[model samples]
Target: MPDLLVGLVVLVGAVVQGAAGYGMNLVAVPLVALIDPRFLPVPLLLIASAHGLLALVREYGDTDWSGVGWAMLGRVPGTALGVLAVATLAERPFSVVVGAAVLACVVLSVLSWRPRPTRGPLLVAGVASGAFSTAASIGGPPIALLYQHSPGPTIRATLAATFGLGTLLSLAGLGVGGQVHLTHFVFAAWLLPFLLAGFLLSGPARRFLDGGRMRVAVLTISGASALALLVRAAVG
Candidate 1:
């Protein structure tokens, strides 16, 4: 029953991410944190990596390789910083920070702050993504914000490539810190089918998100999910 609930969450998160380019973590993190904090960080990262891989396979040709390169450069250091923080601080505080970060990005985008996926912004977003993704398993918002104005395919493909590589780096960092365990992979395996289901569901959702609807969905889903994280953190 618990796994069923978690699977459902992963399913929905995948669909959101599949259509809007990002939101899997935003939707999955807080609720999973409530269900089993132990399943977090590692399991979600694994699941997210899979989701990114699926998106990449679907839209491999549309990625912004130059932006991905810059983002990766920043992700190296940002991931290290995140590893250090996760090693030292409690997870709840990081959750609050990620929640706030998502909300802040959403607000800026909503207010017509158009950030392009150029070198400077990609680097900055990559850093934020690495740190947040490593610490809270919710790194998509920073990178997603920059690509929010892009065509749906570009947003999906680029973020997918970036996230797939970035997540591997984070997992390696956590492994070195002795935070990752064999069991986490098993837990992620349990959620894998539902994650795939969500991605499949997202195929049709992409149509629904066309004609600038993807941008609105991105902002709305990200903002609402951030609020949920904030509330969950505040209550506990």
Candidate 2:
């Protein structure tokens, strides 16, 4: 029953990802961690990996491969470093850091103030996304910010490819860390159908949602999620 509940959450997570071009891990990881921390990060990575691929397929012709390629250059190394750091940190501290960083990004977005220097920002965004995603399964902000300035279709396509690479890097790093196990793989597999269903349902919404409105929504939800994590950390 718990796994079933998680599958449902993954479905919702997938819808968010499909509509917003990011948020699979943002929504899934913290929630799943409530059920099982050991299982949360790796399985969420796998699920995101699946969604990334599906997204890439859906937006194949629209991608800006140059952006994705440059992002991956930073993401691959950053993911490795983040996995190492996470392996050494206590769970609570790690969660707090991840949540805080995500929240900060959200606040900045809501204010309509973004990082400058568009061309160079992608590398930094890639590194941040890869690191956070690997460490805490909440790497959406960095890449999402990068995509926010792009045309809608291109934004979606580039994010799909970029996140796909990050997930691949994460899989390799987690396997080396001894965090990837049979149970995680099984859980991810079980959640796949539901996730796909949610993504399908969200496609129309994504098309119709105005970019400005979506940004506000993303910022609001991300801020709220971050605040909840901080409160949870304080209590625990």
TM-score of candidate 1 on Cα atoms, chains taken together: 0.89
Q: What TM-score do all the candidates reach, one by one?
A: 0.89, 0.86
lDDT of 1 by residue, 1-236 (tens): 77788889999999989998888877787788778776688998899888888999999898888988999998898888787887898877877988987898899888878888889988998898888777766677788788878888988889898989998887887788798999999999999999988999998889888766878876787787778767777887
What are the per-residue Cα lDDT tens digits for candidate 2 across 118-146?
Answer: 55787887787777766655666776765
- Stretches of candidate 2 exceeding 4 Å from the true structure: 36-39, 88-98, 112-117, 210-212
In candidate 1, the residue pairs with backbone N, CA or C atoms under 3 Å apart (3 or more residues apart, or in different chains) clash, namely none
Model 1, global lDDT: 0.84
Show the lowest summed lDDT stretch of 10 residues, model 1: 132-141
- What's the CA RMSD of model 2 in angstroms? 2.6
RMSD of each: 2.1, 2.6
